[model samples]
Every structure is written in structure tokens, then in C-alpha cells.
Target: MDFYELVKQRQSTRAFDTERMVDREIIARILEAGRLSPSACNAQPWHFIVVDEPDLKNKVADATSARLLGMNHFTKQAPVHIIVVEEKVNFSSGIGGLVKDKHFAFLDIGIATAHICLAAESEGLGSCILGWFKESKVKELLNIPKNKRVVLDIIIGYAAQPLREKRRKSSEEVISFNTYQ
Candidate 1:
């Protein structure tokens, strides 16, 4: 698929085909995209934990559910979850961030994740980047160290639903020339 088309196709898929398992080759390609993504000073302060085992995936999905709000209940249907963990930034990236007054690690992780979702789209898979979840439960379930932070939980699978048109502001409304409007 063309890169622009892939970007257009990538969406936060909420409904997944529970019966269909994503191919390992496709998942590997998605991860490869993330691995090659650029980071601040080449720090690459990120680690990915792939959750595909049914029991473990269900456990991770459970952590994402909010019974009271009835939200993210669909995660259980997703066949794969990629947990992105924040690792310590490299020395130069840390220094650069401190000097520039910006959190480059977060930016780098976001970029890598974007690459992941786009790659999934290219591979004919659906994906959603979920942030609303019980971090402590996930940490315990995955045996992630206390020093590490779970940044994102990306659910991946084949979509059970068709794409909805993207709703967004027009270029004139969102973009400006030379100065803020």
C-alpha cells in the first residue's frame, strides 16, 4: 500500500475479528517498522512486550476494562497486544532533553508507535493504541520492573467492521501560514 493511503487507512479499530489470528510475519513487520523509527539522539528508549498467548492476552485485556464506565470491553476480542515500555534514555538524549526543556523520550515513543500502527495498516491488520488501562495491574501481569513505565497498549487483529470516514478539521481551520491565526 502507498504510504499516504496507509496513513489514511490507519484508525483506532474498536471491533476485531476474534476468530482470526494475525500472522506472525505481519506482526514481525510491524515491529520492524517500530525498531527502525528514529529517536532523540538515537536513544531508542523503548521496549516492546508482545502478548499473543490467549490467557495472558485476556489478562492484559482485563486490565484495560472499566466495568463502571463500560469502556474498552472490546479488548478481550483483540488477538494481539503490544505493550510499549519506557526505558531509560541514553546519556546524550537525556542531556539534550534537559537542555532543551522537552521530554524527547515521549516524542520518540509516540513516533515509533505511529510507525507500528501504519505498518499494521499496510499489512491488512487493524490496530488501536489504548491508554486507558490499569497500569499497576499490567505491570504485575507482565512482570514489568517498577523502574519501567508502560506507555501504550496496542491491540491488533483483523477488523470485524468497515472503516468509518475520518472526521477532522479542514486545512484552513487547522493550519496557518507564517503566524498563528
Candidate 2:
């Protein structure tokens, strides 16, 4: 698929087919996209933990949803969840971030997240990037080290819902050429 079209096709899929499972090959490709994503100063600074086992996936899904708040309640319907863990950046990337007052690790991870979502879309799978989960619980469940941080959980599956049109700001509102016009 065309890159532009892939970006347009990628959306936060909320409803997913409960029965269909995402193939391992497709998941591998999506992960490959993440692995090859560009990073500052060659610091990858991210690790992905894939959860596809029925019982464990449900437990991770539980960590993501809040019943009273009605947030991410549908995460359990998806067959897979890929947890993104933030890692330390290279020396130069860390120094550059400190000097520039920016978090290069997060920026790099965000780019990887985009690559993952687009890759999933290209593979005919739906995905949702979830950031509002219980991080501590997830780490404990997955045996992640205390020092590492869980950044995001991405759920993937066949979408059960129809495509919804994307609403976005006009190009003029978000874009500015030379001199920030």
C-alpha cells in the first residue's frame, strides 16, 4: 500500500473481531517496522513485549480497562497486545536531550509507535495505541524490571467496526513553511 494511503487508513481501532487472530508473520512485520524506526543518536531506547496467550492477554487487557470510567473497555476483545518499554538512550542522545531540554527517548519511541500502527494497517489488521493503563501492574504481570518504564500498549486484531472518517485540523492550521509564517 502507498505510504500516504497507509497513514490515512490507520486509525485507533476500538472494536475488534473476538475470534480472528492476527498471524505471527504479520505481527513480526509490524514489529520489524518498529525495530527499524529511526532514533536519535542511534539510540533505539525501546523494547516490545508481545502478549498473545489467551490468559495473559486477558490479564493485560484487564490492566488497561477501567470499568467505571469506561475507558479502553474493548481492549480485551483484541487477540494481541504489544507493550512498549522505554529504555535508556545512548550517551549522545541523552546529552543532546539534556542540552536541548527535550526527551529524545520518548520522541524516538513515538516514531516507533507510528511505524507499528501503520505496519499493522498495511497487514490488514486493526490496532489501538493505549497509554492509559496501570503501568505498575503491567510491569509486575510481565516481570519487567522496576527501572524500566512501560510507555504504551498496542492491541491488534481484525476490526469488527466499520471505518470512521478522520477529523483533523486544516493544513493551514497545523503547517507553516519557512519562518513559521
**Could you give candidate 2's per-residue lDDT for residues 58-171 as a string of tens digits?**
999999999999999999999999999999999999999999999999999999999999889998999999999999999999999999999999999999999889999999
What's model 1's TM-score? Answer: 0.97
Error of 1 at 42 (Å): 0.4
Off by over 4 Å in 1: none
TM-score of each: 0.97, 0.97
lDDT of 1 by residue, 1-181 (tens): 7788878878899999999998888899999999999999999999999999999999999999997899898999999999999999999999999999999999999999999998888888899999999999999999999878999999999999899899999999999999999
Q: Which candidate number would show the highest lDDT if scored against the true structure?
A: 2
Clashing pairs in 2: none
Query: What C-alpha lDDT, on a 0 to 100 scale, does residue 90 get in candidate 1?
Result: 96
Candidate 2 versus the native: TM-score? 0.97
What candidate 2 gets wrong by more than 4 Å, as runs, is none
Report the C-alpha displacement of residue 82, candidate 1, in angstroms.
Answer: 0.2
